[model samples]
Target: MQQQPGLLFTLASFVAMIAVLVVVHEGGHYLAGRLFNTRIEAFGVGFGRELFGWTDKRCVRWRVNAIPLGGYVKFVGDMNEVSQIDPAIMALPERERRGLFAFLPLWQRAIIVAAGPLINFVFAILILAGFNLALGHPSSPPVVDKVVEGSAAAAAGLQPGDRILSVNGTSIARFEDIVTEVVTGVGKPVTLDIVRAGVPREVTVVPKMVETVDRFGNVTRHPQLGIVRPAEVIEDVGVADAFRLAVVDTGSIIATIGRTLRQVILGERSLAEMGGPVKTAQIAGQQASLGLVSAIAFMAFFSINLGFINLLPIPTLDGGHLLLYGIEAVRRQPLAEKVQQWAFMSGFAALMSLMAVLTWHDFGSVGLWARLSGLLG
Candidate 1:
């Protein structure tokens, strides 16, 4: 049977990506809790009412909840009133609770909270590595695939068949090297050695400084030769090269995320440029149309971003808990309950406000609200 790929496929893919990320994130908490000897009551794959659940011999209740947004693990002695604290735990002699979470050392508490983000980081690296291995190493041969008419390349007498041999008196062995020279030489006259129809020719072209936005919303200025990159044949790498490529790719993704955040902070981009869950589903549909490989790549990109965002030191997030633990470690005691309550409330309010604004922007971008307004009118 043929699989009909449509909006449904996109919706399913979006949910699946979220589910995988939730498991990895929450599994870290569950595993760390067990390692720290904390009693875990329930490990749920989603929130709200349980679709199905079962208890293990070790007394760990695992469940699939109806809501597909995220998952959680309920721990013993947690502040949540819903979790049943064993009489044994309460009676464990106040001395025992003293060193465990209700009693454990501060360092242990920090580690437990930190594990979730750490797992996410590891997941991103592994996914990138898997993709690189499967897709093959990228090649950078020096060839001009397309020359924009009236652009620098065309103005410099560059044709579609020109093979770049050197740039700005520098020898070029890789296509990437050629690109680096051209981009970095922006606003400077670059001397190019090209083999056009087997004739070695030299031309001087002043690169134009152009501003472009990366996928993560980063705006960058670079020299533009206005030539399109030709498709290079991919070659599978050895085990070592494959691993190295994965690491490099992961670093690139992290850098992109950082640049985008900086741009957002600097007001180089608007929140209207950001996408919410609705836009993400649409993107998933677009990727699915391209093929499975593209869809998987999209998932990896979003997963990396999700992991990075959750690590921000804001209240109600894992990073926020880590921040609190750090303060506790320094102060030699927990902060007042009232202070914690205030912080959490403030954080919740901020998050809700941001989400509301972003959702409106999303609806505006897709013209959903416009359609509804038209209907009313």
Candidate 2:
């Protein structure tokens, strides 16, 4: 098949992201199962035909499969003949009955299911903390990076080297402070004290309502001032600042995810705002092409996404399974088999439908259809 010049690179990145996330997610299940002494039949990375795998000490088959999208850990007896009311179990050999997933204690099963999502979140927090420790906290300094033409900053004669002193006479200590003031000051003229070209200057500008597009392609408006960070403003800080910045950034990302999800649920946002594998690959490829810093940043963002999605309370997801575990714990019994099957079917269908929509959007946004149509024409 003919390929786009850099298409393979993009696909590789997408695969890598999925593979790593799947391993981490499945590893959580494997660990939890081991802790509870549950029998693990197979732990496979990437679904489909097995490419290579080894037998672990516990006799579990550990292997990589041909598909790179994700992995799974099969628990013994998880869907055995006994649990499924299959007559096949009666005819099976005695050795096969020992470690079926249904035989495990309910508490153990719950823990095993919950661990996957928990690990994803833990991985995100760790990555955030590690990044902060390495790069230090990002300071919101009041410095101009860019002043686009016709923008509030440009209209106010703001220059790239300007250090903002105050916004509307309010003392600004950090860059984010200016943003906060600007967002709230939308449509209102605000005075800025700026130090530019080694001289203090004064400017006034109004924040404009700016349209913002999120990951899912939903658009919203917020106050914006077309000013960016100055290139020369890298203030050095101590370890304490780095740790603080990491925690703050992590919390901020999580809050943003929560808000985005809420918007989607409330119908304020559309599912198109969501990105599937195609978008991820394109983004990852773009980031990779940009160099190390950008790629690392993308990794951080992707990790947070991994954590967030896995926690959704949908059947076939870690969060959904955990929710079921909670119910089982309280009721002292498993949900009916029929109910579980239906729920899984519903969740799987929903996910597939979402994937199809996102994939179609991805192609359409990139003009793939137009390109193909042109060829036919």
Candidate 3:
């Protein structure tokens, strides 16, 4: 079935957003290839027939296409879009195939493949750093405000207006840190160094396990001390502080995502929590509606996710290629052609299945399915 022309606006927005990230990702491969002295035949910003483009002086076809969904970099002596090796490489003269990607050493190929995801992470960090500097990253100090009556905090002799100095000797920088400390120490006693009325004292409290549901109906269990964030006061820091906080923030995000993936793998979390491209597009559209800052924040978030996803050691991804290269390095030869072929097919199928499920899930999320059912009725 043909897609309606009315969806072009949404498609255009999605394409434009994805194109920027894809450029950053594919450009990493291009630069890495150049650094490794590999010959490039074509560098496409999108797949399929060329919409319009120009060949560089080095004879590389740098082009964009009608389909702005994704991009690729084709190297000399490659059979298809990805840098998968071609059988014809064997027929080439030694010196000729030497500059080809496949003929490059295993370590070099691994670097080239891994570069794309690595650069995406760097891009995400830079974007987050920019946001921190511009928005004045709210550094809310961990000052106790409202303590739930008869709760663990109250039972521990904690009172309102007490400033939490540290948790388990890890100095508290922000109110958010308190949550981190308490949640991690769930069901276990935690020492808090508090400053109250110009006098310092130590208090020990145990966080109670509590289950909460998010907007998506996902339930998460955390240790709660029944304390709320003090108040809204944005602490402006220096350039050094901005980058330091940015790195911390980015690392925290990566850790959280890693934990979530682990939970899914362990069957502790629902698979419905995982989202695909359509889900991403829906969220992106919502964020874009808020304003440019929101959109940029969303981009930074997706950039981090994109980097992490590509770095997974599943087939057809950068990590998968790196894994193959690692095997090749150990064995001193490439895997059999049949094995590589099977792996690629499996990876492709897995990727497509994930996309299909996510797209179906997204329709329900955006109310598109309800609207369609209404029309049918």
TM-score for each predicted model, relative to the true structure: 0.75, 0.73, 0.81
Candidate order (TM-score) = 3, 1, 2
Please write out the lDDT profile of model 3 over residues 26-91, one tens digit for every residue: 999999999988899998888888989999889999989877777888998877886677886788
Report, for all candidates in order, the number of backbone clashes.
7, 16, 0
Better of 2 and 3 by lDDT: 3
lDDT of 2 by residue, 19-80 (tens): 77788878998898888777778888887888988997889998788988777888765452
Give the poorly placed runs of model 1, Cα more than 4 Å off: 1-5, 81-92, 95-102, 139-147, 151-225
lDDT of 1 by residue, 1-377 (tens): 22335768778887887888888888887788878887677888878999998999878888899988778777766654122223356567665574244556777777777787778877777766776678887766788888998798889878887888988777776677677566533266888998889999998888887888645333557679888877876878767777777666666567656755675677765667667877777677667666778887787777777777767777777777778878888898878877877777787688778778888887776678999999999
TM-score of 1: 0.75
Any runs in candidate 2 off by more than 4 Å, and if so which?
1-5, 80-105, 142-244
Model 3 ranges with Cα > 4 A deviation:
1-10, 148-173, 177-226
Against the reference, the lDDT scores of all candidates come to: 0.74, 0.72, 0.80
